[model samples]
Target: MPKKTRRSVDGSRLMQEDEAMTTGGAPGSPGGLEEIFGSLDSLREEIEQMRRPTGTQDSPARTCQDLKLCHPELPDGQCQPQGTQKY
Candidate 1:
């Protein structure tokens, strides 16, 4: 009696089928979804950081001194005690 031979399956065909099923046959570069989600996550982190308080001193003297240095064009009164801005 002669022994029967088994045929091998094509690996490339299997891979293609898997990719099609996973991506739903959408026409786009690979891994595009991951990149977009990564960008959104980073943006969310940045927004959260902005929402948090900076915990810096808000004393009138310190604020006035900083304003004077940054806005030399402003009159000394604006950078002084009564006119000092919190922001």
Candidate 2:
């Protein structure tokens, strides 16, 4: 069996790491972690809004009706009642 040589583990540090170490908010700086948390909270709110049901009118049955209206040649079984239609 050939002896396997381990490669050097040390790699060049990224520029972003150096910047992150140097540049930071002063004591008076308004926006930093608080701003990030606020943005995250807003994002969570938006995600919750998206996760919630919009309305019953825009449901799968309505979608099936729209699809059926667009393509009448498609079998009724492909839409609803007799068969399952997924959004």
Candidate 3:
């Protein structure tokens, strides 16, 4: 069970301001979609950077063998090399 609550005018005003900031647009202004797209592009770039591997010891690049060395801790047998059997 839940009780219904009404939003106050002040809360509504704050939400409008937050929306403006999120869209990078003022009330009754154009180019809001462009601004939002630009923000999204920036966010995409940030996410790409975070996905890249850092050149530190903890984030050092390793080969498939190295990955297999740590395979016991891997989920779904990831990094485990497949065997080549002769017929």
Highest TM-score: give the candidate number.
1
Poorest lDDT segment (10 consecutive residues) of candidate 2: 53-62
Question: Which structure is stronger by lDDT: 1 or 3?
Answer: 1
Better of 2 and 3 by TM-score: 3
Residue pairs in steric clash, candidate 2? none
Which structure among the candidates has the greatest lDDT? 1
lDDT for each residue of candidate 1 in 1-87, tens digit (9 for 90 to 100)? 556455656679778767855774423466666777789999987665444423234322334445555545655443233555544
Rank the candidate models, highest lDDT first.
1, 3, 2
- In order of listing, the candidates' clash counts read 0, 0, 0
Model 3 TM-score? 0.32
Candidate ranking under TM-score, highest first, comes to 1, 3, 2
- Across 9-39, the per-residue lDDT of candidate 3 in tens digits comes to 4578778877876776766675677877899
TM-score (all chains, Cα) for each model: 0.35, 0.30, 0.32
The 0-to-1 C-alpha lDDT of every candidate, in the order given, reads 0.55, 0.51, 0.53
Worst 10 residues of 1 by lDDT: 53-62
Estimate the TM-score for candidate 2: 0.30
Error at 1, model 1, angstroms: 58
